[model samples]
Target: MPMNLLHRMLCRSALWERTSATRIVPWALTGLDLGAAALEIGPGYGANVRTLASRTGALTGLEIDPGLAARLRDRHGADMTAVEGDGAAMPLPDSAFDAVVCFTMLHHVPSAAVQDAVFAEALRVLRPGGVFAGSDGLDSRGFRLLHVGDTCVPVPPDTAAERLTRAGFTDVDIETGTTSFRFRARRPAA
Candidate 1:
């Protein structure tokens, strides 16, 4: 997932980190227990990982960008695992995680089919009864401007539930906010 220079800079900025830590992640995770092991599909500059690592006992970040993934591994190696991989086709084992999350990054996946593949992969990697939750910005003029020269495919909140259900998720939930949408779904325990 390639990002424009401005987008890349913003992701690595202090403001982005602060907002992600204080607002976005907290809002998405309300009432949800991430459990012992959690996997983040696209940690980007790891702004969310800082918060996620504190909540879960063991955390893993699977990033598509090799450089970002390497940096994450170098910086958070002691506290978390960082793997360079695609969300649509994870290099992880089935039922290996207690939770899987992605935030503000799915739009970079290039297409709806890939996004659905990511959804399915998230379900596959979760332990039965595991959770998948995250947030992404809605399509807007501002959002579009921020993604110029990038692969931007915003996932409409309206259609997310159906996509999740089709991916074999249960209890699918999507909540649209002022500028973004948050979602959560569960893998049935039975």
Candidate 2:
């Protein structure tokens, strides 16, 4: 099976963990208000969707896999809107979301160009001063291989902050302590 096909299948499994409340709660406490309308890239199993929806007024999930998108739709219904699309080329307009969240989907995206495009899209859709945070399995001493279908990518942290900085995000902060690295960035207020 192709890697994309495997991701599609995994998106349906409820076992996949979502956002880390322990990590997110502190960020929220620091005055990053997520007002309403958040956009989540690759919300596998609707974990982040549940977390975002609980805090924000509305949430939208963009997923490349139809199976996962459909499962999310069936599970979330009207509370969270799930759309089938690529993160690198989102259909929404600029500054469309109060915040943008991408979690555990970077390694699966092949090529640096695609990563740039996705980061650009995330920055484009976010409101000024809006928060953008995500976690990716990066290069660590105990790095493990995550088999997403037929493709296996390095589950180690890459240059996510540099990518975000190039995309015009400011105040970029990255934390890489555990097996995964979490990135928290802010869009400069205009």
Candidate 3:
């Protein structure tokens, strides 16, 4: 079935929050020490991009939706560089970002392999010792109201950790709250 306007707006809002909230607080708490450059995949409405841009030395936002990407660029102006692109195949080179953040975009990727590709791309762009963090709603009774692109993605903590490990991230940390599962993983320092 086609999504109504309200559903579309809700999905977009949730996506923005899922991708931004998980990282924002932790980043702020850690003093936003992300190095020279950072990247946010599927930045949705650019909430994460705004925060990261303010904290990091430089920030890039990649969004598949042209409309949203344009809006992000306009909104963020010089604080961030917005790109129209796919997360699975990023336009940036390996180790381009000191940190990579992805919100609730994995499940909307449509296939497990694509999700893996996105995760791998995130790892590829991250510098050694860099961090990647994301959050998504879990399929708990309380979170039944949570939605991602019209459906729920059951993001269990263990499964998210496994995925991060498979994507070459070490020191995986998974945290769960009442409504969401948050995963933070780091690339090893050489």
Candidate 4:
């Protein structure tokens, strides 16, 4: 389901901006070049698209919410492609992207199995040696209250990397903070 107005506002709020997760997650993904074809799984409100666009030669995003996807396309359509699509079952061609990114949205996946499928899908869409990077919020009372009415599952510390490894990602590195976890994992070269 699409986020309501309140949820949308909060996702794009200063409160969300100030979080350490927002500041540090990108760092964990450093060194693996974002390359020409980059994809972000859930770019809410198009805030990071500008920064990412500067780094990537071409950028595309898959967003679950049709309304938000339309808004993103309208706002950044010249440089980025924003489409309404499912993360776990993206329609993109295999090995099409050089990098895949997500942010603060893994918890929204309904189940661990589904989340793993999403990870596998990221691997499927990535070209050889491409990087998959992201951060998801840790389970917390405050964050939960803020995201009330959504099915949120904070990945336990140290488990995300293991799951990514199981999903065929190597060189998996996961970093944990008080409120969230970020990771960078790569598909092996051909």
TM-score of every candidate: 0.99, 0.81, 0.81, 0.90
**Worst 10-residue lDDT window, candidate 1:** 71-80
Instruction: Write the number of the candidate with greater lDDT, choosing between 3 and 4.
Output: 4
List runs of model 3 lying over 4 Å from the truth.
1-4, 11-32, 141-152
Once fitted onto the true fold, the runs of candidate 4 whose alpha carbons sit more than 4 angstroms away are: 1-5, 14-25
| Local accuracy of candidate 4 as per-residue lDDT tens digits, 130-149 | 99997777887888787777
Clashes of 3: 1
For candidate 1, the TM-score is 0.99
Q: What is the lDDT of residue 185 in candidate 2?
A: 86
Which candidate gets the maximum TM-score versus the true structure?
1
Evaluate all candidate structures by whole-model CA lDDT and list the values in order: 0.94, 0.72, 0.72, 0.83
For candidate 2, what is the total of clashing residue pairs?
Answer: 5
* Tens-place lDDT digits, model 1, residues 11-54: 99999999999999999999999999999999988888779999
Candidate 1 stretches greater than 4 Å from native: none
lDDT of 2 at 19: 31
